[model samples]
Target chain A: MTELTEIKKQDLLYQGKAKEMYTTNDPDILWVHYMDQVTALNGKKKVQMKDKGKTNCAISARLFTELREQGIVSHFIEQLSPTDQLVQKVQIIPLETVVRNYASGSFVKRYQTEYLQKFDQPVIEFFYKSDELDDPFLNDDDALALGAATREQMAQIRQLALKANQHLRQIFAKMNVLLVDFKLEFGLTAAGDVILADELSPDNCRLVDLDTKQSLDKDVFRKGLGEMVPVYEEILQRLLKEGER
Target chain B: MTELTEIKKQDLLYQGKAKEMYTTNDPDILWVHYMDQVTALNGKKKVQMKDKGKTNCAISARLFTELREQGIVSHFIEQLSPTDQLVQKVQIIPLETVVRNYASGSFVKRYQTEYLQKFDQPVIEFFYKSDELDDPFLNDDDALALGAATREQMAQIRQLALKANQHLRQIFAKMNVLLVDFKLEFGLTAAGDVILADELSPDNCRLVDLDTKQSLDKDVFRKGLGEMVPVYEEILQRLLKEGER
Candidate 1:
């Protein structure tokens, strides 16, 4: 607590659509300020919702802490405030690692098939995170040939992503939430180890009510199904209740 | 020759942008009539070129024959005419197998990168061949989940495509032509064996002069750079000359 009060934010390092990154007193640490902004379709559709950032921070902190306890390494250090956190400084690999338990969203759209298609196994995909090209879907070979990621890094990323999906699927199932699919980002540490670096929240995940098929994640905001912040809060509260139990 | 004369082009079975298929006397054999039509960007740009179909037939027949000599199985049976061929009847898998030695065309456009970026190793990609969705790029898992291809089928397709790539790369290099990339299709025989299928020609391959980097394949018609029929004829002539040696 003393070090937290003494350390000061130095300079803005980077600003993304939904979060701002800043340098901190410790060179190995960074400060992430999650904004109230929610973006869909790569920020083409966006809105600022009250307490959205706080909800995301709570969910991400709890999930990352749980993941660490489960032996998955991540960059999350500590929650500094309701909507801010301190994290390890790492170079982000410019790829969006997506894992899917069901065919939805871009999957259904790309295949031009009926929605809510179930799969016997989960699917993992990667997209180059460039807004200019609209984040085109990339295969393993494309990732290597384009120099976006090495074969070793991609293998590790896929392994970690599937593990995260399995853990999240179990956690959400306890709350009667179906974890449909989610996106993850990884970064290379100074030691060249790839670690999960992005916040895991409704904003980066697709969750639905197991019974009603109603949206419980960012799809609620993307589809205008209902107010999103309350749903995110609901998710956080459900997890907290499960923790207590 | 006797069977070719006796078996007339029967009922039209299928009609694609560049070719037409007809049932034959034997259920195991089908007749393919390649048309003079040329299409690019999924048929958004199209034109009918004189003798284009004939040129493609010559190249595909010769290549398939050579591949057969190299112990690779394919659907090609025999050439019936300049623009028509008899092929084994098999169910065509709806995935386009694309192999690349250099980044060009849609690859450059999708990644928004400079063209002609070389790769140390060839890159293999798959696209679900649906005109409705504009033939979206598909990962191996996406193919399985969407029922486009099985894991086993995908594995076999990749092996065959890379093998074909190696053979073609060597053949073209002999003529001082660099084989940039090419698209392939596979089909399942009645015996449940996946075999190489579909025509291979300048229309489906990217070729450039090794020394001058001059476009020698479909890019001529795709980019409206110049006449394509002459270039296709040139490719066929070069391959024929190599056969003589």
Candidate 2:
């Protein structure tokens, strides 16, 4: 990938709750630094922890590589360091695509459904990603009305997201983790192809241990279950076993 | 329409917050009695007002007839009395289909947009009709996951709802009322054709006068504006002027 050793991280492009994005010497590349931080409630509550960034960095890189091997296009290029990576820069769509295999998080809160209730079919939802608007849950029509994406783009995102889900569930299942649900951010390439973007980590997924039923994701931070990074590392350790197949 | 004189209302089928349904002699027909009661917050608030039912009955019948003339198939058959009508009994789909020309009500609450921001195009949303679940807002996928509607039925519902909105907006415009938004319900006929069901009235529509921008619908009761019945009567008077055209 584009002489990875020669790439230089430049100016900071963005600083999100858990990651920092930087422009790179290569115009099409972005440098992402996973931070030793975690957040819940849309960054209302945040904390710093050791090894969080490295664990996430390894997991995201491995997963993106695995997904790419399965022919799912993403922005991820390659991992540069324990907590840094290079990815293709894309115009981020302002909609968050969520795929749910079982009920958890907001799904349980909104519908009062039983926790871990397996859906007969995966349920997909969209949310306008505006912190000012608290990322209000929306439908495809709302996405179009907001100019977040077009009908064809949404259809494309749906196809890509479902494919990602099928592959991801298999990966997690091999780790003995139930992928309850996950949030995805899509972006348009310069040529206008919708592709998966943003970091894939426990920060955006609700994962549960199949046997212990313990949460191995950010819910540890959100629900105050206990130490957070250890669980994420558990995920990283498991993924290392299920590493880039 | 069956002979209104010979039809007999038998067993009470269902009692809703604002209306009651009864089995009729004709197997294909159901008797609807619009109650004087008005409830908000999903029936958590309740009140009875004089002429509320009759005004709604007249308005719903007139609008339904107008839509039928425009070739939009609906369950409405004929008016029976000031507060009653005959409607074809189809299995009601448990989803609230909402169409919005301008944002108001929950749209404002959810996204915090301006109270009456006109949309580039009508925005459609669906809410799962469940009191036990507080009628959670859902997308097409969620509806399918809930077994609320089939894919084909939802597509047909969207088409019919949009057409109804087109004609309803025109009817309201003639009366100088801004058709901000409204909710609809659809049912499946025995033949499995999706058709519009449920009464259309100020109770389900947000209407505002063009000149004064005054609320002419249930917001009177909801926002404690003033006497709710007189405002509904004002709408009836205006619709009567735009009658049968």
Residue A128 of model 2 has an lDDT of 93
Candidate 2's error at A115, in angstroms? 2.0
Candidates' lDDT values, in order?
0.90, 0.91
What is the per-residue lDDT of model 1 for residues A83-168, given as tens digits with 9 covering 90 to 100?
A: 89999989888889999998889888888766777778999999998887888999989888778899999999999998888898
Clashing pairs in 2: none
Task: Name model 1 segments beyond 4 Å from true.
Answer: A1-8, B1-8
Can you write out model 1's per-residue Cα lDDT over B33-70, one digit (the tens) per residue?
99999998888998999999999999999999988888
What is the DockQ score, from 0 to 1, of model 2?
0.80
DockQ of candidate 1 is 0.84
My TM-score estimates for the predictions, one after another, are 0.94, 0.96
Model 1 residue pairs with clashes: none
Write model 2 residue lDDT over B62-160, tens digit each, in one string: 889999999999999888889999999999999999999998888888878788988998999999999888789989988887788999989999999
TM-score of chain B of each: 0.96, 0.97
Q: What is the interface RMSD of each candidate, in Å?
A: 1.0, 1.5
